[model samples]
Target: MRADPTRASSADASETDPSGDDRAHDAAVPIARSLEAILMVADEPQSLVSLATAVGAPTAAVRQAIESLVADFDGADGGTRRGFELREVGGGWRFYVREEFDPVVRDFVLTQNPTKLSQAALETLAVIAYKQPITRSSIAQIRAVNVDSVVRTLLGRGLVTESSTDSETGAITYETTELLLTHLGINSLDELPLISPLLSDGRGGFDDVA
Candidate 1:
């Protein structure tokens, strides 16, 4: 037998709300956590459009949620220390360690035994630091040897970084890192201790320091 029209009307009436505000609220916590994880794993800064699509939300809403997360991390709720933080740089959002804890983190990471550097690597770094924005071929010309391995090792260690690529020749250029400044205990490149006096011997030849 078919159900009665009257019964169907009763069921509809029971389900209806006059105010029409009974839609269940969606929790933002899970979405926020996913956003955090994405930023944390990214090797570099992430963009708003990319993150919004990743979290399945509108860009504006994602931006607000990211700001909220930043506030939460900066707050002192007294739990486990946060492993990473959300930061804005170069007009993009990035995850980085909190500045206050960087020293501790560096100390922990640097405790490992030293790795050896070849004479070529040492010379290549010196040339780049003193005459930066230099190309790999220039370095090779100066050292009179192939600088490929030296350049590769420097890039891997973060002691050197690419400055730009020459448009005409498509040559990649390298420069010293800020880490080099800190390592050398100097305020800036201009403060690098002078070796010019030693190089300026009367006939442009100096005694070897052996």
Candidate 2:
């Protein structure tokens, strides 16, 4: 009997291989494109499992494609200025603005608020923004003043939040809120306006003048 090539091919195609190499390849095409779409549409970083399920591909394969896409972006020249980067934050993967180009990027996107922050409010906010999830006592110690009023003002302005309470000490830990990022016109706290002098100010006394 002569061997039938077409029948063999059909049989091979129909067979369910435990190994998903072939499926991974076929899935990768749409998956790769879908990953881009998801990242573009997402408000924040998404997880590997989320991307895989969203693109209907295996998590491993989607991760591989994501790495490839990131490599391609890094290799491209315009990409650096565009300031697009892929990063993992809060235990999930997401797209982020590259740190090197934030100034120019913010100029185009963020509008300045005419409202000015008082020295005390600015001081408290700075502490919360930098050493976030920090206790009120810690902030008070740094500011060298009672921060109850400052904390209340920040909370009222929607820029900071009492993130947690210490189980043992019962102290309230404050941190910058999502509203803070939005108000600052940035995507994350990591992109907060960098004041080199403020960062270097060991005494924690710095001006927030525009």
Candidate with the greatest TM-score versus the true structure: 1
In terms of lDDT, the best-performing candidate is: 2
- For candidate 2, the lDDT comes to 0.71
Cα lDDT tens digits, model 2, 94-198, are 676687865665454334433566898987898788777888787878788987876766765657865766665555577887877887798987676655555
How many pairs collide in each candidate, listed in order?
Answer: 0, 0
* Cα misplacement distance, residue 178 of candidate 2 (Å): 16
Question: TM-scores for all candidates?
Answer: 0.48, 0.44
Of candidate 1, the 10-residue stretch with the lowest lDDT total is 201-210
| Position 16, candidate 2: lDDT | 57
Q: What is the C-alpha RMSD of each candidate to the true structure, in Å?
A: 10.3, 12.8
Runs off by more than 4 Å, candidate 2: 1-26, 76-82, 111-210
lDDT of 2 at 82: 40
lDDT of 1 by residue, 1-210 (tens): 999999999888877744333321124456677888898666445678889998898887787778767877877465455766788754567777787876776565455425766777887887787667888887787678888777867765667887866666545678998888887788788886554554546222112221
Candidate 2's displacement at residue 84, Å, is: 0.3
Candidate 1 ranges with C-alpha deviation above 4 Å = 1-26, 76-83, 117-210
